[model samples]
Target: MTAIATVTHVDLATVQDGGRRGLAGIGVPISGAWHRSRYLVATNLVRGAEDPRQPAVELLAGSMELHFHLPTTVAVVGPAQVTVDGLPFGAGVGLAVTADVRVVVDHRGPGPVYLAIAGWEAPLVLGSAATDTFSGIAGTSLRSGVALTGVAGSGCSAGAFLRQGDDAGGPLRVVPCEDVPLPVGPWRVQSTARSGTRMVGGAASSSGSRPSRPVVVGAIQAAPSGELIILGPDGGLTGGYPIVGVVCSADLPRVSELEPGEEISLQPMDVPAAMQAFAVAERERRVVHPGVLGRDGSRRGSVPDDVAPAK
Candidate 1:
């Protein structure tokens, strides 16, 4: 493997790809990047296209430093102050560097920051490079002196999307799980991890343990302890607690960006609305890299010739 860069410093980061999908039956979580939109934006800024399977550094919090072994281009997306070789550089754009150059990112924020190298490669496990925080599956602990392998960068133009927080600042839309309605109020985020985001002091009430049932990401479970646990990308496959609702895919990004002590509100909607909301949000996300072909070989947000576009 060709050494691309060496880690000099890092705080709570992981190599994540699209993650292991369709393995939940064998007991595996879809432990991939938390904020899909931001992750894609970072990849596009570096690679000129969004490949979910492409590995990127998922910086959760704090700063990181790296020394390049080879000349390459990289992109840092999200809220952060980035500097290369002691010179201040702007985030959300591709930055070219020479071998032995030092790059530093100071990111201590509520949401995650994505760092995508142009040709960075990661070892794949279960058809993915993502680290499962809860299960410790395919995990890589980033530390100093670690040599990362990748090819030379095929640089792209400066392109990225920086979405800091929920600019809408509205209630998170939720779809009731089965017939159980989720209690809605001003909920305060207590704690968060890749496994789940725990919130308390809402209208949510405690419930007795039910039979272990299938659970997916974004599931809102009402625990016996009276805390609401919203499952993250690395959350468990099945849960014993009562599931009151599931956060809509459109709003999952907001859930991923929740910080401790931050107020979160939930608004229940019907299944059709949830689906429509997701479709609409996905349509908007393609603007991050307009005209770039996605995995399916179609232009981002472009309607197929065979099918009618959504009204």
Candidate 2:
């Protein structure tokens, strides 16, 4: 068996994956990767698919570094420069490594970077490997000098959709709304927490704490002050805030990537339109880089067994 890498320095990082599902009725937060699509795509890039339950290192808005301990490939998600052995590398791409190689994360870029190994073998709890920051379910946030292990395997590969560039299109599209006022222009990210990303300059027609109510991943609740707070990966199973509108599943990636102080917008959309957008996004991602997860959310092939260190 081959050892993967050892964590040298970490800045507010944790292990995260697809997230827990189905326990919301009993009140369990769906603590997963902030950007689900990015996580899935990144994992699939390195492993040809995402296990959904496979854990990956989730880095926040700070610096983190590691030392590659074996021969394998890895992926780095989001906008951050990856330096291998003192050389600058691309973001949203994979890199090859051997024993004793140094990999550093230049967190100066717009972040929430995800670091995933080839054969993810992190410990799982409640059917997920994602770290529940709110409840500390699977495990606590990662600290410096810890060694993260992955299943040893043979071979190395690259992803098809390893394209370089950012997609700065129009405002993100959201589902149709009722009495809730349109977030007219760019709204700034006032702050981010495990529960949600609070936006400034929006008004909530009605606001007040109520009994904890069931909430899904992208529920956008409005405060009496009109400020909008979109649920994060660690969103509570029940919330007391009044939900004004819901963000479409297709735009969840960009929504989760919202950094504090950054400005963005949301446009109105319908159910059918939203579904179509999601379908299109999936197809595009696969077309660029074929993956293991399909429409039914099943893997194309059997998952490889985790290998132990060579005897």
Candidate with maximal TM-score: 1
lDDT string for model 2 (1-311, tens) is 34577888888778888888877766677788887766776777677666576577878768788887777777777767788888776556555567788888765545467777886577778788878887776664577767777676542464334322335456767774556665645678898876788888644465576787777777887777878888877876676777766888888877766678888787878899999988877765531333323323343444323211110
Give per-residue CA lDDT, model 1, range 119-221, as digits (tens).
7788888899899988887866788988788777665644434343335488988998765657896899999898999999987655587889999899999
Instruction: Estimate the TM-score of every prediction.
Output: 0.88, 0.84
Model 2 TM-score (2 dp): 0.84
Off by over 4 Å in 1: 162-168, 286-311
* Model 2, position 58: C-alpha lDDT score: 78
With candidate 2 superimposed using the best TM-score fit, by how many Å does residue 228's alpha carbon deviate from the native?
1.2
- After superposition, the stretches of candidate 2 with alpha carbons farther than 4 Å from their true spots are 1-3, 160-166, 177-186, 207-212, 287-311
Candidate 1, residue 96: Cα displacement in angstroms equals 2.0
